[model samples]
Target: MTDLHRLSIREITEGLSQAKFSSRELTEHYLKRIATLDGRVQSFVTVTPEQALAQADAADAALKSGTAGILTGVPIAHKDIFCTSGIKTTAGSKMLENFISPYDATVVAKGKVAGLVTLGKVNMDEFAMGSTSESSYFGATKNPWALDHVPGGSSGGSAAAVAADLAPFATGTDTGGSIRQPASFCGLTGLKPTYGRVSRFGMIAYASSLDQGGPMARSAEDCAYLMNVMAGHDAKDSTSIEKEADDYVANLNATAVKGLRIGIPKQYFNVAGLDAEVKARVEESLKKLQEMGATLVEIDLNMTESYVPTYYLIAPAEASSNLSRYDGVRYGYRCENPVDLTDLYKRSRSEGFGAEVQRRILIGTYALSAGYYDAYYVKAQKVRRLIQQDFLKAFESVDVIAAPSAPTTAYKIGASLDPVEMYLGDIYTIAVNLAGLPAINAPVGFDQDNLPVGLQLIGNYWSESQLLSVVHQYQQATDWHTQRAAIAEEKA
Candidate 1:
């Protein structure tokens, strides 16, 4: 039999429907793998064996009764940021370390209804602030490719789990490259849907305007399956779009890149510190796409120069406003022996939040302050619009824009102590989030270290189906996504 843990969602579902194996057997296989390997990866914050086994049993029954969905009996992990009923949802912060959600986040609930079993809640950057997952209060999630290297931020845990085959796929949130950067770092396919394409209800707030939840998996086809279950309008979330969800998988193999106009953002190639080899790999990918019947066009997107600063300012400002609910009076962590209301607020926040989260909060508060609001926050909003306009103009003649997901591959843990250096790692991905467009990270090649290098495809708003199809076509022609880390081979 094939390695149950390594099979894709489509394969797993087909096997279950055919009675090749029970959902209990598949779920237990993943559970045992997680118990054995997650210690080394540090991917999961909580492992719910009891909950998972119960759900797997139900899935087995459903499969036997001929009532199964594509994801029935499949196991996946959720980023700790998403609220899960009766499960600890930490957001990788001490502030919510003890908090148990009474209701599942819309995404989690939806996945449960789809017959997908939750393996566990994975780790993330504390409050989703840092580009590296090291900022988590629970401790950093190590890159599965290289244990000494850092997994990309916020959604690192989910990325690590999928890359290591601890679970078939996982859910991740992309506020500022949280999904794509980690996917790039971990050698996985990840998608950040258009803002409001997926409900943000019960997702711990980071930057309300930029925060979005999406899927991380081994291949574009798997991600498309997960997206079908995850995307839709929900009245519970005010930010949720009212449009009907489309069948993301139906167009997977039906579309081709022939005559597809692929735009190359000139600014992306010439970024100050982009690795030469990484640039070469991106160019090679473009050439591959062109050979596959796509045309490449070099386009100028000058507003990209201002994306990093604009995003830092705007995201923090929104984060400042959204995270204000975690005060002492609320359900999160509270300081003991507070002398007064002021003391409680000050001590609770000071003690609960990590350095990175505190740093962003202070920066956000300052940006939104009376004296700096116009100079920083308001001006940043204007620049954000300019960036969006730049993309709009570029898309007029092109079907999609392509760029390197990150300037380089995964770096050693603690190698980037300077905040600016760490933040700059996401230079290519932040702009898409600022513009609230859909983007995907697909492995294009490997660096000198043999670490994965990914190229990003950015699409206009609500174009997730097109983006996934493009990625699927590219994967069909390349073997980059099929390469797994030595850890998987070592375990086998």
Candidate 2:
């Protein structure tokens, strides 16, 4: 029998509605799975069993009263960066290890209002730096599919938890492929909505322009359902788009791929270091899309190669500014001995941040320094606009662009000793964040090692419904999303 914990959110909801299971039973099923598997996976930084059960009970009451919302009673986890009231909100950093938010982020607050049970905060890259979860001060998250491999990050924990059935689905943020890369590595579906599509009122910022939250799940439909609840305008966040969110799942049945122009950027395919197996799988995926009646068009995104340099400059420049608030004087970690205020700032930050984080902060500080601002930071922002223009030009001819989510599948933990090599893993994904466009990563096929591979689908701004529709149709024709890791099953 399939474990209830392994079921999708839609399946769980149906089971509850039919009285086949109760909310408490479903919540317990996941909590038990976390207990059994998370010790090895290290996917969760905190697991709120008490709060989850309490919320589950209330969900049951709401169901009895016929007042439950779409996500009511669904047990889900949040990326540690999304602050949760009273729950330890560590951005996988020792600096704020004990810091608890007095209130929830707009996303968490909205999820609570929608009646989604909180499973607790999953681990992430410290301060949301690094492509792999290895930068986490808490420790790296193991990919459930391959114990030696890493679950791609900074949303590694959220992706691994869902893939391992520790949570039905979870929330994640993408500031340069954090959500999509991990989702690809874990064989889960992840969506990064357009900039300003989701409120960032309480999400720990890495780069304000690039950061945005979205959903990760076993299927695109589930992602759509979760996105429906998490997306909306928030008065608290000035960047939040003040528009009504449509029912994203309502159009999943519209599988009309006819006349849908799918752009394949020649630059992505020509990028060096792409694995042969991954390339084959991506080509096969394109063939499948063609078979589904979508028209394939070769397109050029000339600025693609500039993505890495542009991102390294822009993200860290913003990160240095955003992370400046972690001084011990405020809410987070503090140094014990204080000779002066300067010592407090230096010691607190030095003691708090991980190696990769400090590197970026230094890079950012240098870029934003008075002497270098016009040469590096300003120039990078200009290149960012050019990259955005590249996508805009492509979208003028195509409805969506499809490519490999990562150059390859999950890499063994500590495989890339050089930070530059690690940054290259996200080469295909960072462009979307740089452009502030919505993107989705969906399972394509397994590689030679039998590990899953993902295909990235980039959509025009606010075209999430269209993107989900494309993935939903592809999923209906393929069983890739239905596959699970043998290790996760064994642990479950």
Clashes of each: 0, 0
Evaluate all candidate structures by whole-model CA lDDT and list the values in order: 0.91, 0.90
Cα TM-score of candidate 1: 0.99
Model 2: per-residue lDDT, tens digit, 134-198?
98988899999987899989999999999888998999999999989999999999999999999
Task: Name every residue pair that clashes in candidate 2.
Answer: none
Error (Å) of candidate 1 at residue 49 is 0.3
Give the number of colliding residue pairs in candidate 2: 0
Worst 10 residues of 1 by lDDT: 483-492
C-alpha TM-scores of all predictions = 0.99, 0.98
Q: In model 2, which regions exceed 4 Å deviation? A: none
**What TM-score does candidate 2 get on C-alpha atoms?**
0.98
Estimate the overall C-alpha local distance difference test score of candidate 2: 0.90
